[model samples]
Target: MANFASTADLEEKKITFEEIAENVYAYTAEGDPNSGVIVGDDGVLVMDAQATPIQAQKLIDCIRGVTDKPIKYVVLSHYHAVRVMGASAYGAEAIIASQLTYDNVVERGQQDFDSEVGRFPRLFDQVETVPGLTWPTITFEKKMSLWMGKREVQLLHLGRSHTKGDIVAWIPDCKVCFAGDMVEYGATPYTGDAYLSDWPTTLDNLMALGAEKMIPGRGEALKTADEVKAGVGGTRDFLSDLFETVKKCVADGKDLTATYKETMDIMRPKYGQWVIFDHCMPFDVTRAYQEASGQEHPQIWTADRDREMWLALERDQSAA
Candidate 1:
């Protein structure tokens, strides 16, 4: 956690908000770094709860300040610990996720819980407050629909993007989407287990939704149609650039350390300052390198793997 770029040495939490469209909102922290809220007729649906119970309550408090509706559901965009471990705070009747995400939860939730908690210590200040691994009471395959009073909620799995079971909450009526890690506004997309080759296509499918407003996994909410497109395009651009550069180096028979160093040097002028750029480069390069070597799916990332990769990259950086 000491060298993890998420905190960049920060010791406290920061939160902010933006009104994306008519009834949609994004609660972003700097960035603690999950949780978005959508208000409907009956109550509210909390997307991606914070890592700990206390962090989750902060979001719930914000909801109370805005409306009195009961939180009817807690939606797990995926099984990442930072995004779903705070479920108990909502006391939601149903926790929902895709079948794939559920499988991921069952496969490695404990490891992720420990891993993320370690990487983002400040974000998980009240680690003991976590109720345990968060599980979706209801799981779906492709898509599902719901109503909050009169507003329509459509949850669709476009395809693999950030994770194997990545899903987006689309409000068709308002053309707003809560894209969890599938897109990031002015931030580096985390691709620890991402299907890099397929992510662009998944993004293309998101474009087909004609979303006018969007809440990316991190950064500020995109309020204009143009801005929304920019966010998606930004992620695609980064992914494409990453793979293309890494592929060339990989093909040139460069070692992992050398290839990662060269790729980062190439990407820096264009994207070095983007949020989480430093933190993501190690994992991103690792995945890109593997894919270039013909690994179809990305290998799973655990806390131990995170450290090993980080130390390897850091040593190379220092030597350079």
Candidate 2:
């Protein structure tokens, strides 16, 4: 009963950005989603591979332009296919992530890959180039630290925001955090599988890092502290306002259909232009509606469910 938007309208590919911060570098594209790169004396580490092997290799090409060091590690912030499916292209000795992420990868990685490939066909340009499901070689519980020769990268499971297994890569010396989908710049946060109640506190923990700059999950790299705050604040605000609106409707004993209609009216004006603003709302509201009604964890989205939800939401939205 969530009013969703279709992906049929988006069409274009743009160059990605690479921000050089002393030794660490952030490779961000125009919201095909962003990834990070850190160069150490002996090797290199990449955060979140692109959607397909071909796309990831493009990032590797960009990396080679900056440094010749081998990519020794690839870190996955979560189990989302767009972020992790490109791991094979790195040829790194190890891939690292949180235990929850690893488990989610094991539980739903294939399904996610199929669903995402269908959702964003343009992003996964060379599906055959994908070597298969990208699994993490090393997994951790709460926190993990890596020292690539002299540079230290701390991967912390700050708390669930975008997903239950979300992690952020912290480069202490540079005071920069590569916050994967946990934050986005000028883009709508996808709350389809989110923990809305916990997302803000997770943002609170991220702010405490005092990061001077940040590379969010998508869009441009945040250069100023205010930009960082804006990115996180925007997502938090959208989710908070959305949850409250949905909750009020539910409290009024409205059905899913009525609540979806009411929620859409409340969010469109303030957040209608963020990238994929329309495409992400249905899933966002669907999960928000469930969470507001006491569903602690979001249900996994299957291809059938994706279509069903899309059609149902589209029908309602079109009628209005």
Candidate 1 C-alpha lDDT tens digits along 1-320: 33777646456647776566765778887644656788888789988887788888888888888889999999888888888888998989899999999999888888888878767777788799886899899999999997877888898989998888989999988888999889998888888778888999999999999999888898888888999989999999999999899889988999999998898889999998788788788888898899889998767678888888888788878888
lDDT of each: 0.85, 0.85
Candidate 2 global lDDT: 0.85
Off by over 4 Å in 2: 1-6
- Could you give me the TM-score of model 2 versus the true structure? 0.95
lDDT by residue (1-320, candidate 2, tens digit) is 44234346456656665665887777876666788988888888999988888888888998899889999999999988888888988889999999998888777778888877777777777798888898889999988999977767899998998999999999888788999999988888989889999999999999999888999998788888888888888878888888999889889999777888888888988988888888888888899889989999888887778878888877876787
- What are the TM-scores, per candidate, against the unseen true structure? 0.95, 0.95
lDDT of 1 at 218: 87
Task: Tell me the spans in candidate 1 whose CA falls farther than 4 Å from its real position.
Answer: 11-13, 31-34
